[model samples]
Target: MRRVADHLDIPELERRFRTCPDAVEARHVQVIWLLAQGHTVGATSEVTAFGTRWIEQLLERYNASGPDALANGRRRNGLKPSLLTAEVLEVVRLRLADPPPDGGLWSSRKVADVIAAHLGLERVLPQRGWEALKALGWSLQRPRPRNPKSATAEEAQAFKKLADAVAEEAAAHPGVAVEVFCTDEHRLGLKPVLRSVWAPKGQRPTALGHHRFLWLYVTAFVGPATGETVWYLTDTVSKPLFADLLDAFAKAIGAGPDKRVVLLLDNAGWHTLPNLVVPAGLRLVYLPPYSPELQPAETLWTLVDEPIVNTFVPNLDRLINTITERCTNLTTRQPEISSRTNFAWWPANRVPS
Candidate 1:
């Protein structure tokens, strides 16, 4: 006690040992406090659950630097200086856009090798390529799956114009209220859409599954303004099924003479109906070819599929039950649905019918 008393307050040390914010530092303090109470290094190690050599190192650091030394359990040497520069990294990024010299895509080792050759170095650590990417403001992201065909400039511009006009008209003609909703469908089975998960160090986690079974399809409609959704689960999707779904949707939303229900949908074969029975007071607004991005209802499929991901269903009945429960749960989460479906150009502040 007398030895450490000159440098550190005894009561202060006890208090810090009890309630220190940093777990690592608090552990070191506990070691010091036990030493102050006259325990040998070996005895302190047993009580503190630390190794004997670790205790000896702690004692050496404390004897040399006093209480301040105990605050940090380990000393951190400054990072090695970066050999890769902005211009070099930028070159790497641009060159990575095309196929690599040896392969289809650019990899960390290949990129590192390329950097070494350019800088006239004997070798560069392949691991540094990942670190350099982060430093250069690149992030690892799961790219959104999109179709190969792209929307042309004219199509996008036309959509913006159409959206603006719809907003204006809906606002101006509230009596002939135009209720715009987007609808889409998705298929589900026993297969899992596995995503990244937190796992133990150096151990990889896998979302394992068996053969596909009990397939089902879901068609849903979303109202961007009120976050209301109308959906149906069916065995298959076809023109007849679509017609039935559309009729059900019309009844669910109560489309009548007072308003026009503008239902936005994709250009699927089933969607292309020459004699499609669009119920009275309902209009089918077919989206541009190959543009799934335009349909707000496309977002609902993700929410609907959440229950089936990384999961197993033995039979069709069980899967249907699970999906229905999730659908019912989603209907209560109006705010979430609203945020996902809120199109920038949709009519603002109109009363939801």
Candidate 2:
């Protein structure tokens, strides 16, 4: 095998190995060149970290067809040739999105077999199925489990127009500095169970889900333009409690005789109660009933849950302490909240000075 490289000696082969663009091919060239330099195949295998049999095959190919045989074959960039073309790949992507026709999931073998048949080829490796799907821009994703409903086209259009109009009015108004704030409420219990996390290879994580998993309500008002936020946590979430939170939020936003807040809220039962207290300089605006899709503050719940997500707190006091700490931290993260909640139809990113 070493003598077969008589024409292309170790010096020239070493130059070719250095000049080769691809690392894998360069390795193949180096293996044959080393054998030419009087190194045994086993030593070459140990040095190259490639198996002995693969080294032998490299030598055999070089002996049969010279240096060109050591280069990449029909496989392009380590990918198989079966699913290489675009026309065959599009069909595979379409089929891959749906389950197998016989009422089960699509396995790599099934996909590879189908694609091979489509291309009029004998067979394709199961691993190539993954490459084909990836080439078509598909990914292994776990979509939101509950398939929540979205606003209808008409509803979405109407909301966009109305929101745009409100923004325009706020921008054009004279003297009075009006700011839009999206408000929402979330209930957290004393359960520390999360859906998933990074854990040791095959262990299901455990968390403290104490018997008292009752509700602890958190009400928040977020000024998307100015990155201003106010939150209140309590055991009760009625109109009266909402009133107290609104009063505190009023002071947090520097609500005075001149400056005002245009607050947006969902149509919850407590929110619509008669004589519900809306603080001075803060006007409450109700979004359409059952339409949470329009409210920006709903997005803040995922962020506020970060601190206490996978922990075991003893009682309501500890839970409240953790929740309060997270709330205080969130006030400083107004920019993130704004970016997450502020929609394209919402007002400009400016708060009254």
Candidate 3:
């Protein structure tokens, strides 16, 4: 039998146990009250549904700190000071800007080491390190891959130049309706596109892969402002084929004397203006070399791959059919497309003057 100190009278303990609003606190108070009334620890455990060991611990707490200790301890804060103070968090943020001391990716354990060193402590728990990261408003994320050959300054200058050219063209032809669009080509083949998916613990999801060389080209033209999309499927790509596609796109959009369409493109060999034919009312603007990040149409490939990813297709016809269905479905989801492709700095659609 554990002894409870003379903290409160039996009547006061009964009043507290009855008046406690929280169920957990009330249960804890009832345990103390039962023990204070000369009940054995085993008797209190049977009555309160608390374990014998836990009841003994509760008696120790009440004896040490009285009624204040009888309340749910979890609800009480500031009992133990945290080492991750505002100053320590600021130091962590600055350290994160550079590669970690071990020259690898940052993890909870690595962050724990950083925190421990900053406070001059021997060590900190990885769980506490993760909590500190959440407190600092940080999350784990995979970084987008950047091309080594991409010129940042040139990409910025090209964007500004494109914006100015659109403004200038709109001013030059006051009566002409000007619309901006991005165009790109994606190649889908018989090769399986693998992706990660959730499964039961200790069991990995499997995807069937059949590698073949047969290919299909999907050329996409998208209006970032409205998310209106035009898709063309072909067996292959050539300068003549690209010219025919442009003409078809122009006719489909009714881009003629009254409407001018400025098409943004990458510097592919066949896309250059040397011998290739370009239709009237359709002007081509090239993005900076090696800068696919600036091309809004590049983002569409992920959405295009959704139907075929991790699924095996028997032949080129099946792959084409699956992708065609996916494309048709994507056309109806304009808002989703716009949210993915519309960059903050993209030029807005200009109404005719």
Candidate 4:
């Protein structure tokens, strides 16, 4: 190949001709060019080495299709129509809307079987409901589980009462500037996800084992009224770390007793422990147990940690730095929640089973 380039002394021209020529005429032109350059058929075949018959047929095809045939041929393996038609789609829709005979969330395989039975399709054919939903532009997702140790009705009523009292207390005593803050920690693994590779048809791309340790801790503060957030990323979530964060916020608020910060955070043992000793201007208020939805900081974990941090971080330090940067950016960019609600939203509400 190297000698061929030097022999022809037209590397640029060869590249242009090969790339620009109509597919039909390209092979024929190349063969003629090689022959004219003082090369025998066998030698030219060795140099440009395309089949002689194929070269001739291409020349003929060029004469027939003009420049249009230069476009690549339509691939037979491209996406085809589903064997399951509109009728089958209707069956799937109906099955999904209604629960199975044995109540509870339908598993993917069970949903597939239900679809198969309704449309008389093979299980394998309906199993592809997984893909069909994507084709239909519906996100396939599972419901969150209800907490086993969830607050009882009486507990809920008590919380609601406390909430009202807290609101009224702050209202009557405007001197107490109350703010709810939720705090939590997150971890990151250090392994580069090899984005993606295009392979020859029917071949899977290779991958390396992911083994790396990257750790980080984030103390996030979210405003309940607006989903606005503030966060600090550090090497660990120790008492000193929490104390430092609290002290910073307390000093930032200054000498006004009216600027008292009431933190509505999780019941994480560290956050709740009395020995942790919250700063003077700041108070530690706990969110109802098992109620993550009420904590606006939970959004950060769902949105930031799972996708960007988990997938992209490759080394421990890089992971921590990425998280810190992202948290800082998000703190500035997050939109306020605007409306505040009394109770947390959950898909699985307490219902008689």
lDDT of 4 by residue, 274-341 (tens): 67867765656676788765655566664455335225445677666667677766666545332332
lDDT of 3 by residue, 107-194 (tens): 8898888889988889999876787788889998988777777758655555675687678778877888888888999999999998
Which candidate has the highest TM-score of all? 3
lDDT accuracy of residue 312 in candidate 2: 72
Q: For candidate 4, what is the lDDT? A: 0.56
- What is the per-residue lDDT of model 2 for residues 1-353, given as tens digits with 9 covering 90 to 100? 34555659778999998999988889999898889888998899988998999998989889888988988664465655644687788788777777787778776678788788897889988877777767777677876432235556576567654355456646665466667787899988876646567899879788766656577888888877767788888898788878888888888877656666677887788887578977887767777556776788888888888777777777788778888999999989877877887788776533454
- Please provide, for model 1 over 187-226, each residue's C-alpha lDDT reduced to its tens digit, 9 standing for 90 to 100: 8877766656578999987666777755789888888888
Off by over 4 Å in 3: 1-3, 7-30, 39-53, 64-71, 76-81, 153-158, 196-205, 321-344
Better model by lDDT: candidate 1 vs candidate 4: 1
> Which is the better candidate, 2 or 4, if ranked by lDDT?
2
Better candidate by TM-score, 1 or 3: 3
User: What are the TM-scores, per candidate, against the unseen true structure?
Assistant: 0.66, 0.70, 0.81, 0.49
Higher-lDDT candidate of 2 and 3: 3
Ranking by lDDT: 3, 2, 1, 4
Question: For residue 324, what is the lDDT in candidate 2?
Answer: 95
Candidates 1 and 2, the one with greater TM-score = 2
Off by over 4 Å in 4: 1-141, 152-158, 168-172, 191-209, 226-228, 253-256, 306-312, 336-353
Best-performing candidate as measured by lDDT = 3
> Which candidate do you rate higher for TM-score, 3 or 4?
3
